[model samples]
Target chain A: MTDEQRLYSIWVYLQAEPLFWLTLTIGAYLVGDFCYRRSNLFPLFNPVALSIIIVSGVLLIFDIQYERYFEGAKFIHFLLGPATVSLAIPIYQKWALIKSNAMPIISAVLLGSVFAILITYLLALAFSLEREIVLSLLPRSVTAPIAMGISELIGGIPSLTAIITIITGIIGAAFGTFTLDLLRVKKMSARGFGIGLASHGIGTARAMSRDKTAGVFAAVAMGLSGVVTALIVPLIIFLLKI
Target chain B: MLESIFLIFLFQLVGEMIQKFFELTIPGPVIGLVLLLVALLLFGKYSTSVKTRLEKGLTTTAEYLLGHLPLLFVPIGVGVVMHISFLENRLLAVLFVIFSATVLSIGFTAFVMEKLQNLGNQNDG
Candidate 1:
């Protein structure tokens, strides 16, 4: 074979390997991170958003199927579980703060979760969206795994729920702090908890980058809101009969 | 590092098992988190040294993992490709709902929490 054909064969071989996609995922994220830092950590220039755009652009250009890319990238995705469990460390470390503010924290999360669901539900209805779409959107505020489970139980499309959950997270991470600032919510714990309650892990991650106290409270809020939403969504479904 | 990772995964495994057996709505990792927290609390009561060691290992591991937490979600975010057509039609409505709800909820929660905290402090003082 000619030199060009030989190179093409190597390219085709690498495309089928999981390592290739894994590298692309990490590499794209690093580039996105660099840009985010360069942009002075601007929320709109979010690393996850940038990484998604880069990876998606490459996949589109190469005509690679998302499933094929996912095959390799699932390794990273799998880490989300352990990472979530590891949040216990921070929660434990901040137990005293959490214990003292338990009442406020609990009330905020409970109310925030209900508000998120109610507003999303009403808006989806106002838009006259389909029932399954509405159901999928209901869990959009929770973490992806829990949201996906809730979606399945509530007769929504699980995959769509995952996508919606991610989008909601991105929106929250991008705008959460700014919104808090607008409302004059200056306390780190309150800001973190609010973000986590409305946006889950992604918001917590953003809160982590901003402040340690914020990070811990965000972790606490993320876990609490996950449980609260899980309980409340079903009750709402039963009450509304939707 | 390795031991911490193993412990984290072990908790997640047991959590998954429990979730499956009980048909619980909560995710396995979350259950694992609760279990790990309780374990730490209980272990701390018995031996401070052991609890500290465990906490050190876990803190290192958790920091490393969570430091790059945003990276983990990239793969799924890329899955947006599969729904381009579906999103294209409903993009405006979806964005509107998500944007408004997220902002309003965050504002409402933070505002309420801050207000409540101030109230508590005033009462304590």
Candidate 2:
């Protein structure tokens, strides 16, 4: 084959390979990290958020589907659970602080969970959106998987819930952290759970930037809120008879 | 360090087992975390060898994983780009709710938690 033909084949191979997206993700993050460090600002331009925008741009430019990107990216996704479980390390380290704050933690998660649900529903209704759309939007604050499950359980579309949850997660990670600082919240649990309760895993991931202890409580909120939302949402819907 | 990572996965596996056997809706990794916490409280915290090994594991796992925690969330976050059209007509309301609710919840959580902390402090003093 001619040299041009060989180069064309190689290009196709790169596109087909999962290495492509994986490398792109790492590379973009590297640039994001560099910029963050150079500027000496965490809130101004978060590396994760920057890298995502870069990767999304690349995918759009190349016309690559999310499925193909996920084929490589799932390795990173798989780690979310282990990383979540790894939170035990920090919790174990900070047991004293956590134990002392138990009452507040439980109270915050409960109140925040309730507020997340009611607010999402009321806002959707005020917009005059359809009932099915309302059902879909209700679970927007929970973790994506559980939120999608809750959506389906309450007669909402799962796919829509998944996307809504993702957007919420992005907002929490990108905007929530900066906003938290702007609000000047002092308590670690509040800052962490605020993001966690409203945003889920991504929020907890964002919470990690604050401090290990804060990240642990955020994880606490994320995990418990999942259970709480799962249990209560169906009950609420059933009672309302909607 | 390797030993600690192994322990995390071991706990995760058992957590998955417990989840399946009991039909728990809670995620396996979460269950695994509680199990690890329990084990640490009972066994690791008090024992020097266990503590050393665990600290090594925790730091290594954290260094390798935690620093890039946000990266794990990228693919899903990027997926939001695909549904822009669906959101167009309702974009104003949807964006308004998400932006406002998220801000409100965070503020509310912090406010309530701080108030509770003050209440506890008052009781103590």
List model 1 lDDT by residue over A1-242, tens digit each: 99999999998998889999999999999999999899987878888899999999999999888998898899999998998899888888878888888788878888888988998999999999889889999988888888998999899988888888888888888889889878898888888888988899888888886677788888888888888898899999899988
**B1-125 in candidate 2: lDDT tens per residue?**
78878888898899989988997667788889888888777775365866776777776886577767888877766777756667668877777878777777777776777688677762211
DockQ of each: 0.62, 0.55
TM-score for each predicted model, relative to the true structure: 0.94, 0.90
Q: How close is candidate 2 to the true structure, as a TM-score?
A: 0.90
Off by over 4 Å in 2: A1-3, A36-44, A239-242, B48-51, B83-88, B122-125
TM-score (C-alpha) between model 1 and the true structure: 0.94
Docking class of 1: medium
Model 2's CAPRI class is: medium
Colliding residue pairs in candidate 2 = none
- A-chain TM-score of every model: 0.94, 0.90
Alpha-carbon lDDT, every model: 0.87, 0.78
